[model samples]
Target: MKRVALVGMPNTGKSTLFNRLTGGTARVANWPGLTVELASSRILLGANMVQVFDLPGIYDLTGGAEDEQVAQRFLSEAKLDAVLLILNACQLERQLALALQLKALGAPLLIALNMVDEAKRAGITVDVAALSEALNAPVQLISAKYGQGMAECKALLTGIFSNESHQIDFSNIPSASTLHQTEKQLFQRSVHQPPILNQSATDKLDRFVLHPWLGFPLFVLMMLALFQLTYTLGTPLQDYLEAGLTWFKDGLLVPATANLPQFWQGLIVSGLFDGVTTVLTFAPIIFLFFCLMAVIEDSGYFARAAFMMDGLMSRLGLDGRGFVMLMMGFGCNVPAIMGTRVIRDHKARLLTMLTIPFSLCSARLQIFLFLSGALFSPTQAPWVVLSLYLASILIAMLTALLFKSKFKSSEPFALELPPYRLPLLSHIWRRGWGEARDFLRLATTMIVLGVVLVWLLTNYPTQQHSYAELISNLLAPVLSPIGIESTLSIALIFGFVAKEVVLGALSVITGHEGQALATQLAHTLDPVSAYSFMLFSLIYIPCVSAIAAIKKESKSNLYTAFSMAWSLGLAWMVSFIFYQSARLFGF
Candidate 1:
């Protein structure tokens, strides 16, 4: 198959165009270097099925960042048929420098002037015909976000592949200075633009969102609002889903299974149905979080948040990009670990990965929500959740600081600030569904397996001296000091498989669900112990999938083991302190 590589400077809509061309959602965030790895998809062009590779965004081929290196290696090592060079039309002069350099490599090239709509709206005009003539390559004005001019771009690719004209002479690539000069001259002659009469909306919004004094507070408020909205809006939907699942299990599943063996009935009702239902009930909160995150990300606020946080991050020998990845960790630590690829410095990437496990992922948050609502008053529930989030942030920062001296930071903080726009409903839905899909795909199996294991352990051998009881008895002494009961400790073991299973495991063990389960929990654990348990869940070793992601990204078993050990030690110490301190305070 013909392999075409999509190359561009960071945040030039290359990933968006790749999605449009290949019909794939490759995580189209508004920031640069998000495409840290090569993403390839097979697409039908005319009668030929071609493979399109989306390489990491690069500022220049000569740069030495990890992303830059990945792109460099792919270009030099791969047998590519053509190079599709994408450029942000609004930043044409600066973006064209890389385009010119790619052209001088002599590959059959096509230039995609992406975000042309935004460019024209900003009063910039490009003479596409003249620019194409000067570059000696095809140029297409495209708005990848709205799918404009894609058909023409596809046709151009088809022509290029059919003609076999993509062969490049790498012997005489131009120097960086020469490419810069050529790009300047080309743009001066072929592009026209007028000065803006007023500041852009992005500027106006950034004045407040990125203000020196207000930025941090606004960021805090935004995060709090996100959690508030997620819980306030999602709870009813969660209740509905839980009610429906209960109806299915009772009104249908239980009746149908009455004729079966007792063990089979228990397995179906108590094991599979209960476990799956518990997970599915939390889907609303996960979906809402993704939707809101997509909105903030699409509106270009995350980059501003990054800009505002760079100073604090720098103090820890990291940068704003790592902080963004930490924020992403709230949804899931696995992707956040993978997202460390955006950090150009090796040390910063490692540090970011190590700390992300402390980010209070959605699974852990779900448990916290359930516990807080079950144990505390309605007014105190949100604050309890917020405290855990704050602790996660503090722990991550502290962990980074402790490890900062081991590795020298390589790249200084730098990021492009995209213009602010109202997030499109379609885009938001796609992003939300994408995240939900990934969560289901990655976690469902582990959750179901863990549930089955818990059920088997608790139900087998008449439940008097089952495996769960044995394990709980063994761990009782170790857990007593931290105010964690044996049963909760057992559930935490299952939680290591996937945090979503913690509540379900507890329910299975206690033979209860909903408010009944909550009542049972309240009877077993006091207020201080409950809060301590939440803290432990917030900082413990990440779920199994996240460990695998860390191993894959870091390619170091030692480092991965270190991460697990570090988180485990920290969780234990924090929980111990909280529990002991609360008791000492006479609470």
Candidate 2:
């Protein structure tokens, strides 16, 4: 059996190539650090089988950043026989440097010229014969998206077993010969052309987008366009999914249970399916959103966006690299936290992870859409979304400032405006399915338990009164300061597990326990109160999964408790100020 490792920079499509080679695609994007863990699989060549490992894609071999350093040690120390130095043929010069360093480790190397189709489409040619002659080993042209050179890529590695014939033995690693001229030529021969751009197309874009003169306005335009696209294209469908999920639960599930015993029916219809599926009913919107983001990423526009944010990112004591993680936070924070392994600075990484939950995720956007759609005018709904996103950035930056970490951003990073290739339908499906499946699995587990527990709390009556009423009455005074009534507090309690539950719980209680709380709030409060309530809802408490993630990542229950407490406090303070300030301004 043969062993192979895929190596490249972040966003260099190593995972994409891994999928093509091993028939295993774990979600890919233009975003960096998606593959933080090393994934393994088996590949077959004729009758022979090969074990393959897909380690995290890193920009350099230098031991820095958590994941990159971890990967570096893996390559240098692990008992590996061969490695395929995957290169973004379109951006070879930058990728070639890493290839050089990998070759320095004395492994039997096959240079896989990945994204060849992309490079050719971009009017660039990689003279592979010249490349192989210069590199001292086999070089193959491949397009993972199209599976063009995969067979030859596999064929090139068949001679690795015999030391006398191959002259590439494991004992050569770390020997003085490791840095000899033959190794240097192997590194140099692996590439034909330099990076695609001289000035770096990203620098040109960054000069404008990160410009002190125009950056903010351009940033606003980009964000506004993204939000508008999501809501404009997404709102009708978001509403549709909600309606369909409701119809399934209410029109079908509810009435079917009308014949069953009252308790049994509530447990089945409302508690199990309604509670869980209703929260997950927005899967289509989440799926569509992941698709939109996937297209942006695959088309290579996202890297430019990250480059543009470097100036502001640097202000927050992080490099342009950290911007990618923050952008992923808009999708979800868990992956964003995991992605921080790309950052070499531990303090900066922790701060970036801590601040991501503050970013407005798509889950919370549904709440914004519902409120602004119901309460505010249609055109203004977008402003609410826009403001929340802007507020998140503002909050993230302000909080990052409090930590006051000092860092220099002088890395020799180059950008490539490679030709935009058509996103493969299979690639899109593979990426989207991985996330959607994980989400469904999660919905069935944690959120199902949450809804069932809420049902019990509402159904089980205490000696004095109903437990639901007791819960509502108890939280009434606490939420009263922000003008949120007992019903909303009850909704927030369910939301302690996940934000998606707040609306679902509200929909369920519209007729019963929520009635008194709703009436009292409506009579006493105004729109300002609603705004404060929405703001509070957005920032309060890390969800059950988020807390669990914090504990896992930070390795401290105390840290998780502290994070929950501070965010909860911040939510209250922010909501309190906004409500009182709105009143003082005579709104």
Candidate 3:
């Protein structure tokens, strides 16, 4: 088997080309740094088995940026058969510098001019033969997104590896001045621009979308609509899944366990089955949320959002790149924290990692949607969810503001906005399906353990004054101030494992699931207290997975401990204020 790595500048369609060659999703996001880690897959090229690696995008091989360093170390150290250097045809001049550096290394190089379709549309053309002859390397003009010229590209790959003779010479690396002059020469020889270059549709759209007066407001409106649409459309599909899961449990599993002892029956049916299924019920909503996000990202508007937020982000000690990482947190904070590698400044990266856990991730979103819909009316539920999202942004912003002085970043920020294109259906499906699978995996593992633990604590040593009640009694004094009672406190305690477990914990504790559990919760707490609990849940500590990610990324136990402590303290203070203030208003 031969190993080949895909290398390119940011947003040059490397992941798309990797997917085309290997039939893998490879996380095709339009925003930079979304592919923070190496993505690899194996496929057969003719009779030869080939391994393709999609590396993080880097601007310069010698650059100090985290992604750049990652790509640099891999290229300099890894044993490889060929290097597939992908360049955006429309931005050939700016990208040629990296190619020149690679060529200087004497690595086995194959230059691929990606996005030729978009280039042609923009009245740009690349002279492929001229470029190949100038570099003395195999160059293929291909559109990875549309599968144009993919056959020829694969044939070219076979030819490169057929020789089985390649060497990398690190000693011959080119200086910046030499690389720049050579890049200019290469561009002049092989690339041509129209005499009168016209502004693209992306520019016209940016006039409104990126407007100084309208950009921020448009972002807010888009967010509001995103949640509303997710809830309105996803709720029905979730209900259907919930019904199917319920039927599977009640109609099949229940009868199957009929002959079991009472204790075993309760554990299997009420504790494990109900717990996992309750979490599974919200998979549709979470999947739809990821799909909507995928559409925004793949269409290139997410990068524009980062660009628009650059001013406000700088005020909070970050820049546009930090903003992108924060938005990535909405899908999952673990990866978002890992994605902070894109922020070159150490302080800014740490600050962004600390702020990301506050994001309203899909796990927490499931809990919010369930509780809000149970307590609030249908029309009011979406507002409740949207308000939580706004609160998330507020808390993250406030976190950055408070820590800005300690972790100040002087690194300048600049982001390139990719041209907007209609999102590919296959990419959207891959992202959504991947998220849904992750949620189910979480459900079957952590959520199941949490539910069983809750059941044991609530049921063991007698139902009345059980172990759970004893634990909650100890916590009642501290929680009472924030309208959190004993049973709810127990759920919060178990939620430290995973937010998805909170509902499962509720189901086990109250001996109910689905609507029954929601009804039970509705009766247990008033509207203000319910909202207060939601606030606490939203702002409290991140899941255990996220904590591990923070520790590994920051490589500082002290920093990780501080992140945990700060979020815990902030959650209490914020929830207390809301609960007490709402009561004062006579609500």
Identify the candidate with maximal TM-score: 3
Q: Model 1: per-residue lDDT, tens digit, 398-489?
A: 99888999866867688888888677787788888887786676456877777788899997676898888888899999888899988777
Distance from true location, Cα of 10 in model 2, Å = 2.3
Estimated TM-score for each candidate = 0.95, 0.84, 0.97
* Model 1 stretches astray by more than 4 angstroms: 163-172, 442-444
How big is the positional error of residue 423 in model 3, measured in Å on the Cα after superposition? 0.3
Root mean square deviation (Cα) for candidate 3: 1.4
* Residue-by-residue lDDT tens digits, candidate 2, 1-587: 66677777766678888888788867677656678878889978655677788888776665456787667667766666577788777776456656555555566788888888756655667667777766566888888888898888877866553332222233333433333554445445543454453554555766675567786687677677766776677667656765676667668777788999978987776666666655565566566666666776676556666777777777776656666776777777777777777776556666666677787776676566556655666687778878878877777666666654532334443443343446777777765566667667767776677777777776777424668778889888888777687756767887777776665565454432122323433444466877787788778885777777766766777767877887798889888888888888998
Candidate 3, residues 1-587, lDDT tens digits: the string is 89899999889999999999999877788877777889999999988888899998898776787877888788877788899999999998788988888877777889999988898988888888989887778999999988998999999988888446355666667765668888999999899989777988888999999999999888888888888899899989988887888788888999999999999999999988877777888988888989998898898988999999899989999888878887888888898998888888999999999899999988899889998889999889988988998899889989999999999889999888999988888889999999999888988788888999988898888889799989988988888889988678888988888888999988888888888888998999888999989999998999999999999999999999999999999999998999999999998
Q: Count the clashes in each prediction.
A: 0, 3, 0
What is the TM-score ranking, best to worst?
3, 1, 2
Q: Which runs of model 2 end up more than 4 angstroms from their true locations? A: 23-25, 42-45, 48-51, 76-81, 121-124, 133-136, 157-212, 238-255, 405-434, 462-464, 511-527, 555-559
Off by over 4 Å in 3: 162-167
Candidate 1 lDDT score at position 32: 66
